[model samples]
Target: MTTPEPDSQVGIVLVSHSDALARETATLAGQFAGPHARIAAAGGTDDGGCGTSPDKVAAAIEQVDQGIGVLIIPDLGGSVLTARLFERPSAVVVADVPFVEGAIAAAVLAATGAPLPAVLQAADDARTYRKL
Candidate 1:
């Protein structure tokens, strides 16, 4: 197998209060993104409790950094704060979209080689998605 172009596809980070939650979310989103998009997870505290950590967030961001950008999907306010605590000079967007839907949409767009702003928009647009 061959590798995708490093800068062509944007990356995604799933931040949650549970390590299992983050990994599961990333797995679900990865289905839509295929293997082209980089999807990482940053969840739980150092002791694996209900909390977020800046170090984990930074690691997730760094893991997905491919030169294009990284879109972060935080499960809650605390997760959002942790994700923002270690912001980078590079395009590290903290999207305000719903966790699951946002990750799916963002991953799909990013896999298509969408730019940071476009991927962000895709994630943001998921807010209106409904299952009626």
Candidate 2:
């Protein structure tokens, strides 16, 4: 099988119950990936609200899923649900990693032209160390 080429415009999106968490994660990921990486984020509102809509997540993924790659880090419940709703292309990866650090790291790796599998593996490594 031919391996897919690495994505150059790789981006990361965090879906969480708090907008701050999402934004913070995006910022942290930017630090790791540097100023040029493409990172985006969205969060669920409080007051017993549904987190960012699945469509919004899908849109974000679509926006970044160019030939490069796109990685999505979801908080919980809604975040995972939103990711699950999409039919991810080979160029896009949706990870259920709940921690910001791990997600950010994964995004950074993806942004640096790492393959999706490698980036996901890094995210999983981060997830293992995160204090859930």
Candidate 3:
């Protein structure tokens, strides 16, 4: 099989209390969305502790940005608050949806070259998704 062409689509960032969780989730989202997806992880404190860091989050956002908007999915607690700090009316958006599900949904939609609004909508829609 041949590789797909890279597209300038919305990026995704996963913020979590544990660095491992965020990194693994980003990997899962990237894998599901294929190699062209832009996903980053901003988890834990800068000192390798259990917490969130604005600096780390900002770096992740920069790492994945491709002139398009980005979607930030925070795990919970302070991570959500930190994620909100980067929210912008056009270039950046924070999705208040389930962490893993939202990341996967956002990444998948973004990989298809969807716009920020569409990617955000898909992530939000994942909140109502039933897995029964």
Candidate 4:
């Protein structure tokens, strides 16, 4: 296995149809993961509408990538489609998991300096996470 870079955690990108939702989800993730995790929100359009933007998503991925890799958690519909456009095996992975929960789990694991695979696993594992 490749050794993780020192102080470099897997980046996380949260994509949603609403800008506020993405921003808020990132904020909530920060609250749980602390301040060091590289997380970004990509939502809505440049004109601030109720849709996802490829430009915004690309920019967010660029903003957070630190060479470790980036995990993208997309809400649904076009957001998922947009995220898929940027998927690169080693550099970026579009997670197939619940958006909010995946973001939280990914952020928490990434913050702990977990490897990209481990962080991705955490996000995937969140699919079955329960509140009860």
TM per candidate: 0.90, 0.77, 0.95, 0.94
Candidate 2's TM-score reads 0.77
In model 2, which range of ten residues has the least summed lDDT? 1-10
CA lDDT scores, all candidates in order: 0.87, 0.69, 0.93, 0.92
Off by over 4 Å in 4: 1-6
lDDT of 3: 0.93
Error of 2 at 64 (Å): 2.2
Worst 10 residues of 1 by lDDT: 1-10
Which regions of candidate 2 deviate over 4 angstroms? 1-7, 45-50, 130-132
The candidate scoring highest on TM-score is 3
Better of 1 and 2 by TM-score: 1
Distance from true location, Cα of 102 in model 4, Å: 0.7
Error of 4 at 24 (Å): 0.2
Model 4 Cα lDDT, one tens digit per residue, 1-132: 533434788999999999999999999998888878789999998899999999999999999998989999999999999999999997899999999899999999998888889999999999998799
TM-score of 4: 0.94
Ranking by TM-score: 3, 4, 1, 2
- How far is 126's C-alpha from truth in model 3 (Å)? 0.7
